[model samples]
Target: MNRYTFSTQSGKAYYCNSIPGFIADQSTDIVGRLVRHAFDINKEQANAWENQITELQRRLEECGMEGDIIFEYDIVRLGKRIDVILLIRHMVFSLEFKNGKDIFTTQDAQQAEDYAIDIKNFHKESEDLYVCPILIATDAARYPNPQSCDCYPDKQVHLQRENIETLIPKITKISSLYGDDGEIDFDKWFNSPYYPTPTIIAAAVEAYSSHSLSQIAQSEAGQENINLCEAKIYEIIEYAKIQKKKCICFITGVPGAGKTLVGLDVVAKSLDDANGLSVYLSGNGPLVEVLREALKKSVESNDREREDLWKRAKKSAGKTFDVPKPEKLFNKHTQAAINTLIQSSYAFKKDNASHSNPTPENILIFDEAQRVWNQEKMARKHDDPIMAVSEPKLLFSIMDRHQDWAVMICLVGLGQDIYDGEVGINEWFRCGIEEFKEWELFYSPLIFSQVEDKNIDQEKILSCERCHQIDELHLKTSIRSFRADKQCQFIDALLDNDPKQASEVYQQIASKYPIYITRDYSLAKKWVRAHVRGSQRSGVLACSSAQRLKPEGIYVPTEIDVKNWFLAPSDDLRSSNMLEVVASEFKVQGLEIDWAIVCWDADLRRSKNGADWDHYSFRGTKWNKRNKPEQKRYLVNSYRVLLTRARQGMVLFVPKGVDPEEDPTRDTEYYDGIYKYLVSCGIQEL
Candidate 1:
């Protein structure tokens, strides 16, 4: 007769006196209910698995198994009843079911062995025939000894628990003597919902998730490929990971506030987890290329080899495959591209709903979100009634579809740079966009002045009415440009002064930073050309609307060469998904210029409004006074764009006596010109 024995660290032999540690973990239900995931399991799954063993026994007998079955029936002599007991050839065959993974351990394996021996001995004196013990576990993924050590080699079998209906096959197989005929038909068992079906466990690895199961992966030389979360980026990572109450965090920053840095850091934090991904997007095409090149360093550095080395990688899995491993190829750009394509590709049929399957790698970030919000106004479809990308409604629709996925969409922009109409038409993104919004102001934080009471509010004067609804956070700190406390004060004071004082301080600031005022278009063009070359630092050529700065030579377009930008208000411009095609006129703003020339000629100066229209124009298209006012408004916007763009120095030109040293206005139009506009906009004249 077969015999079984069970003992612990104490080494005392265990009898059928009491159940072992196995029974302690079981409450009223199996232990798997305790397992949790990043996402929640539906409630319908709960009641379906609730257990009562009698139902299983009845199910087996109904399926034509000629035997009496008992449910949770404890044998008095045996101490504990088996989950399933059958009578065959007058010998008892006991079956124990392990549905929970917790029961699968080395100790549990030993316990199962002991039970088999105990049951065999229990029926050792059976007057009839052979006796055996059957051990069956359902969906026990963690079952130890899939080969050699335990009797079963496959931890997960193709049979999941369902209505008591599944008991028939389970009983028929376990009850029969062990042999080839006893083998399970996995194809048939897989379709049976009466028990847990076979499935590979979701894997956890120390490496990055770049490869797919369809592809094989080779290990890399160094662990550096995966980025470690550190510093300020860690907070953003925590915010994305653990906020139970959902919040759409819209982080607004100026040109260099490190929005991309923070965004990337968030991406780094999520790299190891299955619930996170990183994506970096921007409106600037050249900048995007630069950024892309920069990121390749990290990816390649982590890989520790050149391109040829990666191609030669052999699968460590020992199986040949065609596809790349997700761990090997899953870089920041790859994730970004996947998510962007997923959102951009959809047919919005009326009344239709969509579902998204999100993995940790699903993330969509808009670096130049302001640009994305607008339909391409200049590139509108000829048949479509609405203006192209600049149209707010269409952009809202795009963002809405993505919102349905509960995607963490991050939008970054500066108040001056964004067209407000194109944002937040969807409910999910509505909160905190305007009033609760952050960072409306962009300036040197400690920059205070005694000469001028306050800095000019661009909207109050320049009439930049777009994005009025957006809640803005002003970044008070200046990291890009540095100025001493005294110089900063001096610069602010000089800007508000009369032309003489303004010129004096402008010269002073220029002396330190070097702003050369040149009326010569050739000089300006030459200086700008030199700056455009990618160097250790950059340079810009700023041209105001009053001055028409023309390149010294005839312009020619070539894919291979640097193209010079000519500042002209009428320069045709277009917006594209792959490009930011603005003319030299508008492009010069918000960018650092090396040298700027104020080009004052007929075409640019003609639109210079009768200073009277300046007040009404600053109030938005509130007037029906005609395009005359509009032209003047556009002209002011042109100037604002020009003055703000230059980093080192800029030149100014005014019609004859319209003071290059002070406010430019005819004596009679003086109040209507610079005075009224300045006072309305809160600019204190020094």
Candidate 2:
């Protein structure tokens, strides 16, 4: 994909010869080039490009600057583009324009700053350089002093349009303090690979809008693995379609390895195909609600913009445009369309099981397939003894109703089954081997490396002629925490009670990814606030069973609106930025925050000998020990989910309990051991 619409070096000479003398063209000719690069150019976009180009050209001529000027630079990670970027003398200036506006808004400022942060965090060429984010409200009445504005710790400065010329000289004087990196090479910077780690919500919105994987995903970190997996799935799908056979595929990966992203990409591609139809089903209620709401809002905003642009285009052409009284020009943004593409797995099962007809969709993609309910849990949930079938078997029966061909793609995350009766991959294997012997199976090789359970018959499944192992189905890299790719390994070793291994891994990643331990709750919150920059998100997280933490201002029993908590603005009281409310593992399993404050409680603490962990449940007034194996495992996995939810870094808040005699539930011994244990594991103290 083309990175920018137009690029030219400052002064009279240009460096790039590919466009052939376009630098000497007029403003109208430059606007034509920008329009060519745009996928769908409307009147508003074209007019804005013209104005920005004309004004920038005048300013460059006045200042006599010597550097590169780029227009409409694409930031693929956010699915947005910068208005203008000026690279001059070891300084990168990101300019955001608000044409015909009289006032500057907080949202506009955040947008400008976010673009600069995206460059510093993801752009390999700008890692060590100084970045300045300037917001221009062309028609504003008052302009602040250029010297009065301060630079953020991340080296971003927010300024108005009037300060652009004056601020350039001031930044040049201070550029020496940032180290002399000399001039930036335009060719190397332009060709640098952009590896952006987008949030799951952002990825889903981009994918559902019909964007390809290359436009939405990272380029270097495991891009080949994801592509190979996608290709292998398509091959299986084609073979099944041509041979008129039913096939099942299993894709396993480490935590935050883009399993959901791969599934969403395939579903989008299937929708674009003329002959095939696919639906993405998930049992994660929070994930589904957040994604659907985000998509609806995006569609509404685009429709409104398009309508406004259409009216402007007609008026500019000197033609009379009639405004419809009762109807809208675009009505494609409907709830029914969104629901058809993404649906609840439970609702799908109930609807299909109530009827005897076959489904129209031939391809079914299941997210979090390991969390599907077993036979007993399904029966208990419905309060019906006759419902003896597991969810996997029921889904298989529904798909088997198709006469010609069908394909089932299961996205599994190992050791992520935190709830009871949420059968892991074993149930699907058993169903395929015993009940549905005719279905062909394709699986990742990682499935065999998991801890052996009595229910899984590895030998029997491997001996079956239909089962095939493919290495491409496994994603080995964790792209969620782009700062540290080995974060999952560190978390795994820490939770497994291997202090030596955890310490070793922590030493390797400490400089890039910070992990701190603190005894005061306020310190943890302060750390998160200090580390977060621009529009990056930060929130407080705690385990669901952390009842003893109520006195410390953390109440896990109160439910939060996942949509608002994850997507709301900073000033909103219900937003995560407030940090007054906390989300448990259940609310944030499939989501992530930029920075996190994990509130550690006595629900899971280190043993007296500091060799193992102890699990407990607070009932009524006192704490009781958890004895069941599944219950213990659930408590352990809850911390796993909480620890891995932050993309940047996190701080563990281990509060110091009061005297045991005054408060039996809040004993000093309960939390002290865990704090010391974490410190020994190489976590720095706050």
Candidate 3:
């Protein structure tokens, strides 16, 4: 009668009727209990389970297979349940049942594969075993041609199809291919350590509502820094409240060290303040859109799912409480809810009034603060009064309008300014000295003299009596590459053209995280398909200025519907899993994917001497290089963003350019040098 139920049996002992007993007990009470506890359980699911159980029982009884059988295995943290997991010898068979279905859909295969992958990646006992995900569509016409298992990497899953009639032969083939080594200990497998990775969508919703971060973020190395950052920010907020003075903190981190997580935590913790409230603001349009839609879906759908359960629990218990209305809290009209908790800086500027404070949120958290525009870009883009001033100066002025104390936290990232107008960290220094001298400034000690690339006035910032530097303000770990901490180091060495160091670091981490390169996009796609298993995400990525990639059949998604592009089913053409429509670096900056194909074009390439940044505008029929410093930097940084987007591994596809006699624009000379450089940097060429 418990929710999220599962049955397990030891290997070598066989089933002994444990699984059969559970399936055959089809009383009204038991069925009702299962229907209530399990999600999306209907006649279709019941029929599928009944058929799958009967077939599995028959196969086991006839074959006399050893090992264990687990029914309805629960991947509790990921919110997934497998139909049946067969632990035989050292292999884990992840089965998904489709009843009365004639064909095995791609989505169905992906769903089965995801369950297998989740166990292989996160289940300790199954990590060393061969995980095979099989989809059994009971009424399918024909069985898939069984392929040898030599092509797959260790623990890498492959999708196999079967029908109810072919189940015995399929099992025999798999068991023979992967010969039985030893009996599987089902008790140990059931209790194996499961490290759950909450998607960014789930993390955002949980953090914004409950301020509980540790449960969602399973990164052991980065959790300390997250906690430290949060504690320091809270300390600053308390000080600002007591002293009745304005304070600003600049929190910096390497690419994916949970800066956004800290920012959302602040927004959640500050929501209920009767007087001085706070809102999370960002300049990243795609991030905002994705987060809003994800939060909306979480609230609306989850609330309805739990409503009936809440009523039933209340009836059994002696106490009654009002059900939480997530829709009301996160609706569009509610300014303080999730939709308005984050807003675009440009939109905030457009809505700014000359003399009034906007919406009474005294505390402001700005994500990606380094990407804020300087005065010139703002003036050219906007006609408002604040357009002539830098964004930081304008924001400081707006916050200073409050008569009481206020706090502003700038969630900054180092070396992520991939746009022309971004002034990096210097804009904040200028604003602090010339515009808002009275407000206190706080930063990490590593920011001052360490920033060599930017022209920051260190003297002006250091001269302020209220300047304070705190070490806890900076996050030192990269949470995105939780398996390989040296991922960012390897990227830096590669981008800096230090091939020796890059190769050394790659050798250290290559076994854990694989990076491949190819001259053909087809090879890259094929490699991605082979390596990716389970519910792992894969996509094609390109630079925003990759106009030449159109000839290679790679088109950048111009108008990205962030939700569908990130969360759609694999079979959908719009989904990133399709590998047809590629997303640009601009749309995928703060996100991570499991596997990716980075299509390298001539926008940014390597010359014989060093890295080359050619900013080209495709006007008429030719590529004209824009001779501007900012434009060149943007082009270079765009590649940097694309290069580091993949969390697990990536394949760089440097095109083999057309002959000079055919298309002069895409000459062979333009691409060969870059491809060679990438190869030299220890990227395995496929």
lDDT of 3 by residue, 149-267 (tens): 55256555467788888766776777677847886665566766565455566577776656555555656567778788888999999999988989999998877777887887777
- Candidate 2 residue-wise lDDT at 206: 82
Clashes of each: 47, 0, 5
lDDT of 3 at 99: 66
- lDDT, candidate 1, 443-507, per-residue tens: 12211210011232333322322122222222222222222112222233322333444444444
Q: Which candidate wins on TM-score?
A: 2
Displacement of the residue 355 alpha carbon in candidate 3, Å: 5.4
Q: What's the C-alpha lDDT at position 468 in model 2? A: 94
Candidate closest to the true structure, highest lDDT: 2
State the weakest 10-residue window (summed lDDT) of model 1: 195-204
Candidate 1, residue 432: lDDT: 24
Q: Tell me how far the alpha carbon of residue 464 in candidate 1 is from the true structure, in angstroms, after superposition.
A: 26
- Ordering by lDDT: 2, 3, 1
Q: Could you tell me the TM-score of candidate 1?
A: 0.36
Which pairs of residues collide in model 2?
A: none
What lDDT is obtained when candidate 3 is compared to the true structure?
A: 0.73
| lDDT, residue 267, model 2 | 80
Q: Candidate 2: where is the Cα deviation over 4 Å?
A: 1-25, 39-47, 142-181, 307-333, 383-387, 451-454
